[model samples]
Target: MNIKYSLIKKEEDIDILQGKESTFANLHYKYNKETIQFLKTHFYRQDSLYLVATDENNAFVALCSLDSDWWEPHHFFLREIFIMPSYQGQGIGKVLFEKCIDHANQFQAKAIVTETAFENIPMQKLCEKMGFTRWDNPQWKEGITYKLFL
Candidate 1:
């Protein structure tokens, strides 16, 4: 299937949170009961990348967003990356992830950081594959923090 990736501007914080699909319902397992780790969010940052992927028929295939870390301007926080379960394991997530990395690079960010539960093996493996190292964050203890120094 052909996928079109694009950048979108947000007028409201909620606009970026749109597009929840039933196709992703099956993904709500133990580690992701009500929503995925990334879905527990508020898209309020103005300095951010709102990237979206749509299939040939203009359906939401995936979403990946990144923003400047509020506490550390030099670090880019990977706000979220959600792919439809049907499209998982096909490298689409990696592409969106690479785009976020590229955006961070363009902004001369020192590193990129993200959080994922230990049970989310796929995300951990993806972070590892993308050169993110496990980081011990004193601020957050609920999830694993991965950091990739640029």
Candidate 2:
């Protein structure tokens, strides 16, 4: 399937990129008013970046959210990465991830970091494949931090 990727530039873009149904229900959050508000607050921040991948029909297939790390100006924290169920195994996630890496590089970020729940084996594997090393004693319980140096 033909796919297009781009940075989310406006609130309307978020509405288009996120649908009512989600493949990541296990993550336990929806694009509701509160979430949308949160996104709106940070979406255009100078230190934040949000990207989306869409199919030919303009439906969202994947998304990635990132922000500058508070403790390290050269580091970026990957806040979210999700791929629709039907798009899994099609390398859409990898493409979205590569976009994040490229964005980091363009901003002169030295590293990218993210955390995933222990039960999310697929995400763990993806991070590993993307060359992210697991950090020890992550502050978030039941999850591990992954870091990829640029």
Candidate 3:
């Protein structure tokens, strides 16, 4: 698989959010034109990283986004990440994850954090495999939260 990473442009991002395979269905709100405009305004400010994995045919096989904020000037909150269903189990997710980790290192973040639904076993397994420790707590949102010190 010859997957290449490219930044998500305005039009492409809108198309993605509206695609049939969108993952945003889990969220309460929908990504519409207004939201797309808002995202464009501050997307780069939050250090948003959107990478599309395209095959040799030049078609997008998968896509992932990493958005983080400097909560403590040295800590990062990894807000989102997702890979398209068609390319789910081909190691593309892992590669994209590594790229995000590498960028996090460059930013000098003391720690990286992410949250996943309790029912999302596959993501939990992947996080564990990538060295993320489950930070279990009674008050934590009813699902597993993983953190890694980079």
Model 2: colliding residue pairs: none
Supply the global lDDT for candidate 1: 0.75
Candidate ranking under TM-score, highest first, comes to 2, 1, 3
Best candidate per TM-score, number? Answer: 2
lDDT of 3 by residue, 60-99 (tens): 6665555665444565555555566677778887887787
lDDT of 3: 0.67
Could you tell me which 10 consecutive residues in candidate 2 have the lowest summed lDDT?
16-25
Question: What would you estimate as the lDDT of candidate 2?
Answer: 0.77
TM-score of 3: 0.75
Q: Tell me the spans in candidate 3 whose CA falls farther than 4 Å from its real position.
A: 9-14, 22-42, 70-73, 137-140
User: Local error of candidate 3 at 67, Å?
Assistant: 2.8
> What tens-digit string does per-residue lDDT give for candidate 2 at 28-59?
43466666556566676686888888889987
TM-score comparison, 1 vs 2, better candidate: 2
Each prediction's number of clashing residue pairs: 0, 0, 0
Give each model a TM-score: 0.80, 0.84, 0.75
Q: What is the C-alpha lDDT of each candidate?
A: 0.75, 0.77, 0.67
